[model samples]
Target: MPKYIVEGGFNFYEELYKSLDDELVDTPIPDDTQNSTNDFNNVCLISNLPLTDKFVTLECKHKFNYMPLYNDLVNHKKKYNTMERKTLKCTEIRCPYCRNIQNKLLPYYDDIEISKVHGVNHISETTLIMNQFDNVSCKSYIAGTCSHEYMCSDGTTMPCTNSMVTLLCNKYYCANHKYFGKMAILKEIKIKEKLELHAKILEAKKKILEEKKKTKLAAKMVKDLAKEEAKKVKACAKAAKVTTHAENIENVIISTQSGCVQLLTTGKNKGKSCSCAKIYQNNLCLRHHNLINKNKPYDGTGTNYGNPEQAGLWVQWVNGQEPEPDTDPDPEPK
Candidate 1:
């Protein structure tokens, strides 16, 4: 039965029981609960805060707070330009995440209520409606927001309409600040980078063309070598055919014993007749006659008709008789 009393004399137990009887429940969720449990999709990728009014959406679908994005762009304009030659322009805007070139950042609107905890302003529907009537095409420069402010040569601070109009050092100044002096060194560096990139591209193209030419030349050489080899093979085949025909003609034998000249038939020498003039019993020359005497019982005495030291073989039939000759010899060798 102890009572907790604090400033303004408020009774904690009395109020707590009264709220419980009224079915009043107080649930306190931590502020970082959403940030810890969910992905950072709803948060700005740049500021790492929740998105609210006056945000910019890039073509890559990444959202950023407007002021931070404008400041980043302004910083890039003052710093070095690292984009490729294709997107090399003074007003080039790029996404910080992917470094992809973007022409403009589209406006992103949220319908959340303005609160001190959110720390963002709420853009009304009337403002959007009036923005349609704005003559300036650039959305970031609308209502003189995110526009460049520079000190002119005449000791005057002037604001530029849009970032589209830019110079070397102080970016996006009006035409009156043209003669405020330019950074010649920065201009030279940019020109040198562009020239080097162009030279590299030309060199790459030249190398590709040279490789193509070499490939074509190699193909042609192989084709010509193949044609030459084919010609040599055809010539060798023709020469072999002619030589075989001449040898066949030289091998035909003629017989003059019975007043009849004909090629041998029905023997091992059927396709090739004898070249000798003298014949044995079957009208075969000594060389062709010896072919039939193989494996026959040999008589001690035999005659080699042509010469004793000749390449012809001689043997006498002991028990077997000579085979009967064909009545009609074939006109052509077998």
Candidate 2:
């Protein structure tokens, strides 16, 4: 692979994809395709999506500082793996073998982010680019050891591939996206993409569940409440009807259960009690009629009937029939 000395502190990747200027010509690429403006511009405008998820391989360094890198990869992984926001700080370490300037490489961020792309963060466009450029690796994984004999994926390797911190990208300044500075950018792009994918799947699942639960629970509760309310309304109506038709009502209703229902006159029968005394007019009980017969029953100051028991005539409220009188001849016109 050709070496590309990366310069930092700006949108170098964007600029590189924009145009391979003559000044940074030494930065290695597969071949100059400046003639293709469209392709160049597209690459320059790298999608904020992850392309691939592969380890960045490199030549080994005799001595290295692992803490800072480890922390960076860890933080980046959160932003990349989940909805967590990641913080990327540039490193000032140089290439061990080539003596080239190494930009900030957050090992911690890369450490956690590079392992995943299966469930949520599956296809990282930038990760793909980085993997293509350099041999990417992880402390928890090993390449060329996919043999069933070693189970590095499960972290249960008999002859474990757990070496000098699962280091990949041993050499820097490589052509393509895995270049020292470019590797970080590519990783970032992948991180965002993966995080998005994970988040999308989670959100979709959550929404579907929420909708289903709401629909089922709300429907059931509403139905139950409606039934209870209907029962209450029916009871209230029955009570109001009883109150309105209390005294004048008769055994008009025949209930299903033979349950005692205070029956009322359902028919259209309008009348007063037949056993009244004052307006008797022959409709009076025996007492008042007898008094009239005697001609002296009320002759004095007070009104009196012939018999005493006539006052106890049960004043039953019966249906009124149109009155029919004997020898009654009506020939009046108003």
Candidate 3:
């Protein structure tokens, strides 16, 4: 038996070895005799155990942060060797305590002898094989009745039932026909454009109608003004015609009485003689004849012509002599 010296002496050694043994009992190891001792020494150092032992240990002199019992280090080394031998090639190596990749302190170890010789095998170059779906149907997914569970790389879960999936160039997608699919998005954009166009059309039509109404109103106003102007012109023409006819009638009366001189009988000049140079009917001037006839009473009617003085003039003119001027005849009897 080789005697070993723990840095913390025999009392500390007993306590540390007991604890390390308990921990190493559950640890796994790798196989391969050529580098097994070296790999085991690395594991012991990582576990904060001493690399030297009373019986046998590696000759490599590496410094450690904490001292460990030699017996515990040997035991842990044995466990690592056994685990290495039993494990399959290309298996991942992780830290037993932290469960993270043991990359910093530990070297790569595998069951493959050629891989160890070449030292080309690395944990970073490892690839995981994904499981394939043999019974999944693409047509059923498009029909919105798929029963597959689609999982994303970020650990998100989604069901395939009542959903659409589009496959293109070895990539999968979730297609939402009502909103998010490529065709649906394009359709929405088209509908929005159509609505905008329709609104513009309606606005243009409204403007056109408004313009037409303005035009029609202007035309109607012009027509009303024209009609009023026509009425005014017709009224002025009718008045002119009436005035011309009256003037013609007056000229005809003057021509007929051109040389008449006759006593008048009616109206304000009833007792005066006509001074006209022309005469016709009843030896009276046309003016006097017309006036007398205008004053004549109807058949069997009373002779009240509203003026007594006019009646007296008519009586005097009918006697065929001028009436005497008004004067006091003779002094009445005192």
Candidate 4:
């Protein structure tokens, strides 16, 4: 049999649906069922089994470690003196925007042409080719990692004479990169904003120091006045003297004006406290401390464990195959 085939008729699947339902009953078989010739049979044979949903994951790595575009390329092209050298080389970097690898890798120019013109073909192409070996090709893939364009093209094929080879990843599906690229671009814009913020903070800091000095001077003036009042109060009080011949003192308890506080007479830090007993010994206050940091369990392997879309934890959900790693523990969890 061919690898794939198509069956017809909408009612053909009725038997398949009935097969799955335990409530289905046909106790009253029609007497002339053989003559009807309209029952579902050929539509769902054991051989016509629907293939289980399948998905393939591409393992793509960076091809060009650096971007093909360089700062000096434009200047060189304008002067007709410097040629913009291709910078895309083999490496382990993802397309900064798509977070993907290339499916197809085009050369900067023809290897054979450059080899013939410069007496060597491997230097440029081989170096670039070495960087992109991790690319993979699944059933469906697309390319959007390169900034190359086809020039000198007609209704037919693109002219290859001066064409720069493009980079692609093993991934064939491209819809994911439409949003992925935007995120990468946004990161670039954030870098610009960060630089501006740094400058603004420096200016703010300079003004703050000037204001801090003025506040310190004002605080000193108020503190000096409070000291004068304290000296006047000290002049009215007398100091008691201690005698060297005095015997060892006994524990004494003292109560404070606050009803909650009273002094301790014995034990550790004797005569220190009886009313100010602590709830816990740990450094964290009673209100904030915990004997153990409790963990809130995940409670779910995922909301819809068997369902891919509902689970949202793994890419395997995109296909109904339900990969085994999700159902069971992985050999390695990195």
Candidate 5:
């Protein structure tokens, strides 16, 4: 005999809804007794079995209460005949209690199959059963529920409910956690902006200082240049004054030498003119010369005149009288 098994933990109503066809007409079951067929052998077998709430049945006339037996059959398809053996002639399924094969005939009758298999009357039970499989939680946020809020692509704030759910952690988060995360991001952005602004300000200040230094250096250079130029002008002026004084002295020397009447005269005033022929050591006539030298003491008592003729002329000139004619002097003995 073929062993009958039924998987209980997995929600059959959800699977039934998932396997349904979209384009199908809603057909209601007839309440007429003649239209219903009953398999007496299957019904007798099911009734004779032990009465237990743990018993579950599949559409293939398989029954199982233990989860291991159902799991072994569903998981190990190569070792289990339920999935691998096509020659068993049990490809079609029928309702265990009602003996109805309407789902097999028309695959679109999923709602009716769900009701007959799981005893579910409404679609809400299917939703509740499916919700049990969703065991995901948000990993991005710590110690809070998901608020489903996020920043949109257009730089605006929007609700995260309609957004695509992330498969990594199911996009679950609390409102407080999401709010704090957003605030942290905004704070980081603000700090970065402030640092950039501070850097720009420092760069501007550095540039200004550099410009001031350049200006100061240029001013100093100009001042130094001006000072050098002034020194050059003063030096040129001094040199020109010295040259003019030297030229004036040179002209005076030339004029005195060319215009003098007594060029043979000696002493400090040698280039001057004189009226008398008898000149003294000074560049003057004997009378003026004797008047200036009269205060000197005489060394000898006799006359010291080497030339008596000039001496006589000097004596007469000093006496303010004309000179007499020349006369012979006494000879000296050896």
Candidate 6:
């Protein structure tokens, strides 16, 4: 039996074990839904604080305070380098909210001061002057509040704080103080505007349909023209049977009696005598004659026309110019 060796003393091994146990107890395993919470009030997921100098992850779109996220990334890299086996290794630089791998983050500037300065009172100077000329308050005196006062449906005048302005009448009134007659008028105006938009959309759709139909009709016409052209080309090819090299040879040999005695050079009939009756001027078939003479006729030009007198089978019949008249002795014997 071998005894396990412990350095320092017996207490050293115990102390090391205690430290390891403490580390295991203190560090909790990372959960995928650790940051999944309903606290989305413009707060950082890592520090749980209002996001300042916010940096949003490109992949997750999760907003975070710049310093906290940077620190987390650094810590994660350190842990990974130290051989810490843990899920959601920060070295990969994951988004704290969704745990998605993040390579870059974009700055989202949402300055409260700038927003307040540019809120309601940021109307144009000309519009301000026009409001002053009309003896009406600019309607937007402060941020998040309306300055317009109007009579309610109850015939009582009240101050409105809503920032909404009706597109039809340009009236500024809160929900509580909105007049019924004005509401009906706004509804009618909205309905009419919707109807007009729907009509325009329908007209656009109708135009698109007409364009599609015209395109299909044009395509059909082109296809019909192509078919007609193909039929004409086919008829011409049939009429001109000697257009190809082989067809020209067949045309020349149609009136011949015997074929050429040239041997085949290739294919299954290689080394065999050619049976083609289309003899050329050299007493060989057109193909064999071309090969021997090294003559390349353009698209079988010289193959169709040849000297018919050079045919080996052609023999002139030599008969006397006049035939003898039938004898009277032959008629008597009949």
Off by over 4 Å in 1: 1-180, 183-190, 251-282, 285-334
Taking the tens digit of each residue's C-alpha lDDT, what string does model 2 give over 1-334?
6555776646566677768575568786665566554443333112322223422222333222333333334444345555434322233333433444434442323445355431122344565455544554433343332111234677875532322322234423212222444556566777998999999999999999999999999999999999999999999998998877773354333212232121222233223222232333344444335434432323332245434332222111122332222233321111
Q: Looking at candidate 3, what is the lDDT of residue 86?
A: 37
lDDT (10s digit) by residue, model 1, range 255-299: 224322334565766644444455454666544444455434444
lDDT-superior candidate, 2 or 3 = 3
The sequence of per-residue lDDT tens digits that candidate 5 reaches over residues 186-244 is 56657987999999999999999999999999999999999999999999999999999
Query: Would you list the C-alpha lDDT of every candidate in the order shown?
Result: 0.54, 0.43, 0.48, 0.35, 0.47, 0.54
List, residue by residue over 1-334, the lDDT tens digit for candidate 6: 5576876557666689999999999999887454555456478877888776444544666777766765565555434454545443212356657767744423324553332111121333333333333343445333343435677899997766576533214444433333442545556757987999999999999999999999999999999999999999998997776467677687676545367666665556667567675666655675556445432222333343343321211122122223233232211100
Q: Could you tell me the lDDT of residue 242 within candidate 2?
A: 82
Query: lDDT tens digits, residues 119-202, model 3?
Result: 112332112111112223456355333333567899997666555654422334444322233343356557987999999999
Evaluate residue 188 in candidate 4 and report its C-alpha lDDT on the 0 to 100 scale: 57
Cα error of candidate 3 at position 208, Å? 0.6
Model 6 residue 119 distance off true place after TM-score fit, in angstroms:
20
Q: Cα deviation of 24 in candidate 5 (Å)?
A: 64
Which scores better on TM-score, 2 or 6? 2
- List model 4 lDDT by residue over 137-205, tens digit each: 343233333332234546453422322223333212133332333344456557877898999899899
Compute each candidate's TM-score over C-alphas.
Answer: 0.29, 0.26, 0.31, 0.15, 0.29, 0.25
- Best candidate according to TM-score: 3
lDDT preference between candidates 4 and 6, better one:
6
TM-score, model 1 to reference: 0.29
**What TM-score does candidate 5 reach?**
0.29
Between candidates 4 and 5, name the one with more favorable TM-score: 5
